[model samples]
Structures are given as structure tokens and as C-alpha cells.
Target: MRKLKLQVQMTIDGFVAGPDGQLDWMWIPGERDESIFEKVIDLAESCDTILLGRKMTREFIDHWENVVDNLPDSPEQPLAQLMVNMRKIVFSHTQTAINGRNLEVENGDLTVAVQSLKNEPGRDIMVYGGANFASSLISLNLVDEYYIFRNPVAIGKGLTIFTEQKILKLDSSITYKNGKVIDKYLPV
Candidate 1:
């Protein structure tokens, strides 16, 4: 079976985004690391399909498709192209339609949908979104791996690590000098 991976950039305090949904704190200001960004692009390429929550899907697709054109060419452009080309499955209750190549809208039981996708023949499925969706997947015990880009700064409070009703167990963790940590967990 294909693995389901949640790849997110989070703060030291465990918030994916700030209270106002701002992610400007993620990368260091005036810092450009092409190698690290390239690694992220490579990870994106390894995935066969992407699972997104409603908010993430809409905002990402819109920005990458429209806004990226006006911005100067940089490493972000390649990453945007990868997102456009990959097959996407957006889970949303309010979203009625989706526009793009190989994109699908899913408003049903997340566990069922994810399980069906995992059973299909392909590379690993990647999940990118807020803690709500991640919590849902964790509750279902469906997530196989987690790739967290832990930033240096900490947000006192914002989004949580997981919003699931049950507690999860961490299996292993790896630390990087860039003040990033990758924590892996096993579903009980």
C-alpha cells in the first residue's frame, strides 16, 4: 500500500500558521536557501497525489496559478509548477467545484477517501494543510509518515499540533542544525 505523508512547516511552538493565517514567519527574512527549497521541490515531485483541505487547496491553487506569474522568477516558481502538475484531492464541505488538471473534490468521510487512495497503485500520497485536517487523518490512524519543517521561532498559540480527540504516540524524531525537527509517529 502507498504511504500517506503529512508534510508541513511548523513553528517551534507547534503552530502551522499564525493566528491571522500568516506564514511570513516561516522563512528567515532576507535569507535564500536554494538547496533547502530544492529538497522541498524534490519531495513534492516524489508524491503521486496531494490531499488538501478546502482552505489550503483554494488558496494554494489560486496563488500558484494567478499570483505566481506576477512575482519574480525564483525557486518558488518551480515549486508552484510541481503543485499545478500533481494530482490533487481537496476535501471541503463548502466547495462545490474545483478547476484544474487532475483535481478532484471530496466532501465525504476523510478516512474512507484516504484509504481508497492509498490502496491505489502509485507513489505516496502527500497531505498539506492546517491542524484540523491533520487531526482527522491522525484520528483515523491513516498517516504513515510526517515531515515537519520546524522553524526557529515559536508562536505562543495559534493552530495546534493535532486536534484529534485521542492522543498519539511518537515513534522517532530527527533534528537538524537549521533548527528543524522531523518527528515520526506510530498509530495505535
Candidate 2:
């Protein structure tokens, strides 16, 4: 069985994005710390599948594919290529069909679908989606590990992935030079 690891970036105030869905508080292009990207690479290398919600599937796939296609020499090429070629399962109620080579549509019971995936023999799976989707996974006790990257800044009011109270056992915590802290936690 493989673990389902959720990786997300959040503000110091526990918000994933601002109230208006603004992410300006995060590191800008020239200001981004390379450590963050490196950390993501480490996680990406450990995963062979990506779980996404209906809302984020298209944008996430297109962005990575475009970045790798246009910027052949991009610094993020390694992660981009893996993401582009990896198997992606989108949880959507309305979307009955998906159009892509490695894409799959899972409109069945979330728990059943996820459990079936977890029981498969493969590399770990990673979750990438909106707050609601993440919250759903957390609420259902489906996430095996959490990789939370907490930025330095705080947005007082915004979207948070933690809607229900969860007791987490910290597996590890590492802080980068850019004031970003990555905490690995397991459900207690």
C-alpha cells in the first residue's frame, strides 16, 4: 500500500490563499527562495500519482505542461516533467469523461476511489487541489502524511484546509532561508 501525501502552502495565519483568492503574499519570481523549489522536487520525486479536484485539474495540468513545453531550460523543468507525465485522477461529480492520456475521472465515492488507489502497488500519491478538496480529504481521515509549507506572511482572513480539528504528530520540521517552514506531520 502507498501513502497519500498532501502538500500545500499556507500563510502564517493558517490561510492557503487570501479572501479574494490572492496569493501575492507568497514569494515572487525574483524573490522566491530556491530552497522551496528544491523541497518540492524532493516530494515530487517520491510520488507517481496526483489527486486533484475538478476546479484545479485543468489549470494545474496546463500550467505545468506549458511551462515545460515553452521553457525547455526552466529551472523547474524536473518537477514539471514529472507532473506532466504522472497519472492524474480528478474527483468531479459532473465530469463523467476526461480527455488526456494519463488522466482519469473518478466520480464515485471519494473514500472508495482513494482507498482503491492506496491499495495499488506504486509510488506514493500526492494531493493538489483547492481548500475544500483538501479539507474533504482531511475530514475523511484519508491523508497519510502532510507536507505543509508555511510562508512567513499572514493573511488574517482567507481559505484554510483545516476545517475540522486534527491532532497531528510532527514527523519533521525544516525551515528554509526565506522564512518558509516545511512541516511533515502524521495523523495522531
Candidate 3:
């Protein structure tokens, strides 16, 4: 079976977003390093399909589509194209039917949907999260690998993906010059 990986940006204190789902803390004022962007592209190149919660689908699609349309000569262009061409599966309960290429809505059992996707022949599956969806996946123990990009700052109280305590073994850790950290972990 293909792996199910989680790629999330978080604060040092473990919050993924603020009380109002704000991400202002994550967008620090500074020039972004090319190496960090390259790491993102590397991850994108490794995955053929992306899994997302309904809450994140629209914004995610729009952002990447804009990247594909406007950032033709950027270092981010490869990731833009990869994101545009890759299959996207959105898990939702109420809303449905997003008309676009390589996009589908799955309103069935989360386990069944994820399992069937894993069973299919593919490189790997990646999840770009909104807090609740990531919490559910972590609670269900559905994630195979976690790629956590931790920023230097902390949000005292906010949304978190790991609602329940679970032990994970560190697979690797890479630190950027700007104090951003990427930690790869596997369930212990």
C-alpha cells in the first residue's frame, strides 16, 4: 500500500492556526529561502495524489491554480505544475461536486475512502490540512508519515492536529537558517 503523509505548518507551541483560523503568525516578514521552497517541491514531486479536508479544498485549489497561471518562471513553478496535475481528493460531509480536472469529492466513510486510495497503485498520498481534518486522521492513526514544518514563534492557544497523545519516533530533522524546522516522524 502507498503511504499517507501529512505536510503541516505549525508553531513551536504546537498550534496549526489561531482561534479564528488565522495564519498570520506563519507569514513572518523576511525573504523566504530558496532551499526551503526546493524542499516543498521535492515533497510535491514525490506524491502523485493529495488528500484534503473540504474546508481547505477551495483555497488550496485556487492558490495552486494561480501559481500555475502566474508563476511560470519562479522556483515554485515546478511545485505549481505538480500540484495542478496531481489528483486531489477532498473529504467532505455536506458540500459536493467541485468541477475540475483531477479533482474528486469523497463523502463516504473516511477509512474506506482512505484505504481504497492507499490500495490503488500510486506513488504516495499527501494531506494538506485544516485542524479538524488532521486531528481526525491522527486520531484514527491513518497517517504513515508526518512532515511538520515548525516556525520559530508560538501561538499560546489555538487549533492542534494531535488532540490525543500519541508517541512518534523521529525519522529526521532539518533546520533552516531562518530558524524554521522540518521534522519527519513515524508512528512509534
Please give, for residues 40-81, the per-residue lDDT of candidate 3 as tens digits: 888887889999898878888888888888877766677878
What ranges in model 1 sit over 4 Å off? Answer: 67-72, 164-178, 183-188
Question: Candidate 3, which segments miss by more than 4 Å at Cα?
Answer: none
Considering lDDT, which of the candidate structures 2 and 3 is the better prediction for this target?
A: 3
Query: What TM-score would each prediction reach against the true structure?
Result: 0.85, 0.95, 0.95
The per-prediction CA RMSD against the true structure, in angstroms, equals: 2.6, 1.3, 1.3
70-171 in candidate 2: lDDT tens per residue? 999888798888888999999999998767548888999999999999999999999976788899999999999999988888778998899878999999
Candidate 1 lDDT trough over 10 residues, lowest sum? 66-75
Ranking by TM-score: 3, 2, 1
- For candidate 1, what is the total of clashing residue pairs? 0
Off by over 4 Å in 2: none
* Candidates 1 and 2 compared by TM-score, better number: 2
Native-structure RMSD, model 1: 2.6
